[model samples]
Target: MKNLVIIGGTMGVGKTATCRELQKCLPRNVFLDGDWCWDMHPFVVTEETVRMVESNIAHLLTGFLDCSEFDNVIFCWVLHEQRILDNLLSRVNHGGFAIHTFSLVSDEAALSERLSRDIAAGKRDPAVIERSLARLPLYGELDTVKIDVTDISAAAAATRIKDFLAA
Candidate 1:
């Protein structure tokens, strides 16, 4: 059976790290980070930018879905709203794939600490961290499964996802 796993969360929530760890547990899979598609210089977020990034993600996923070599396709992104999630799913060609979607959750204090560490290490901008933190509430309102990342390692979170897909 073909499986499409979409993982969403706020910045510094270990989405990418979990994806990397998740890769070790699943065979014959393709993984894509949505942020990688937004690698534009001086990132702009106009209507055009949103549409383009969504289209890009859809296009990349469409390719993976069509490929015969992969049975699992893992997508990691920050999907904080229902409309955004609906808009993204609308662009994809499911082709009868079984989809398991989840949102990684974290407490405010843990989130703040993670972002602070990232900022101190020069890995993330203060403004970006602020924007990401502001979206945490939206994540809780989503319909998908929520995996709390507080007090857990990325690898452990990945294991949880793998177990979820198996069930």
Candidate 2:
């Protein structure tokens, strides 16, 4: 059975870098960025629109799990609530796949700094960063491993994840 790894965290928390490292470590794994789903859609993203988007994502995940093309799947998303995690797990429950989760967190000041950098780089909007930071605390007791990326390099963070998975 293929293993499914989900990396959830706040924006600028090194998810993309982690995904790249995971890809290198587990070469057979297929990587999917959850943000790409939003980018693909052509609708205004209000609260209601976001809910609809998640619903559609749930359906797409179902299809991915049903297909037997990939040996392992590494999915990255900003999972802010346990309910969202539950919904994702429920959809991928079939396949005898071990579900592993990794959450990246940092201090508020550190996050704000990162947000400011991203804003200056035109990588993210200030409003989006504000909203994401506001929802950060909603990610209930993370059942899986948590990595604080406050002062670590992306390579170091990736090594941590690789070690965790190997262990």
Candidate 3:
């Protein structure tokens, strides 16, 4: 059976990193980062753009799901709202696929520290700290298995997720 693992978290919460690690842990895995769909110049957010990006994401994810070479499809994004998750899931054809959703969460201190490091390294903007912190609580409201990644490495988090899938 195909495994469709959806991972959501705030910016700088290591969703990309964890998914990258998970790709290695899972057999015949493919990884997709939702940010790739909207990585446009002067990133604009409107109803049209949102719809377009959602369509694009759904297209790519559906392609991955339909492919025969991969048994595990891992997708990660800053999915802070349940509506967004619902919309994405609705768009994708997940029949016969075991869907596992996860929300990577952390305390404020840990989140701030991680974002600060990213900011200092020029990997992320400083403004992401506050924005990420604000969305931290929103993950709790999502209907997903919560994984506290405050003190764990990305590989460790990936291992935990793999173990969950194995069980």
Candidate 4:
């Protein structure tokens, strides 16, 4: 069976760096980022829009499953709710893949600093930071392997995840 690893976290938490390292370590895996979905239009969230996004994700996974090119998948997203995680997992489960999730977390101060830096770099909007921080608490759950990246570099964070997955 294919191994479907979902990396969930707030902005500036090194999800992309982790996935990059994971892809190198597990060469047979394919990596995906949620930002790629932003182009679908109407970036604002709504019940109908959320359903549509989920359907699109399901379709993407279906295509991956049909192809024998990759042995595993590394999917990264800012998954702030249990329902979103559950839905993603359900779709991959139907494709006969074993699933695992890793959620990166940091203290409020650390997150705020990261957001400020991102804003200065012109890579993020203030509203996006605000919303991400506001939803941080909603992501607290026992099922996820939460990694604190407060004082770590992206490479170090990636190494940590690689070690954790190996264990």
TM-score of each: 0.97, 0.84, 0.98, 0.86
Error of 4 at 15 (Å): 1.6
> What do the candidate models score in CA lDDT, each in turn?
0.91, 0.76, 0.95, 0.76
Worst 10 residues of 2 by lDDT: 135-144
Candidate 1 lDDT by residue in tens digits, 1-167: 89989999998899999999999999899899999999999989999999899999999999998899999999999998888888888888978698888999899889999999999999998886688879988888998999999899999999999998888
Top of the candidates by TM-score:
3
- Native-to-model Cα distance after best TM-score fit, residue 156 in candidate 1, in Å: 0.8
Expressed as tens digits, the lDDT of each residue in 26-116 for candidate 4 is: 7577887876764565468888877777877767766776678887777888887888888776775365666678888888888888888
Runs with alpha carbons beyond 4 Å of true place in candidate 3: none
Per-residue error (Å), model 3, residue 47 = 0.7
Error of 3 at 140 (Å): 0.5
TM-score-based ranking = 3, 1, 4, 2
| Candidate 4 ranges with C-alpha deviation above 4 Å | 40-42, 93-96
Enumerate residue pairs that collide in model 3.
none
Q: Per-residue lDDT of 47-135 in model 2, one digit per residue for the tens?
A: 88777767766776666666688666888888877777887777554665667788888777788888898899999877867876786
Q: How far is candidate 1 from the true structure (C-alpha RMSD, Å)?
A: 1.0
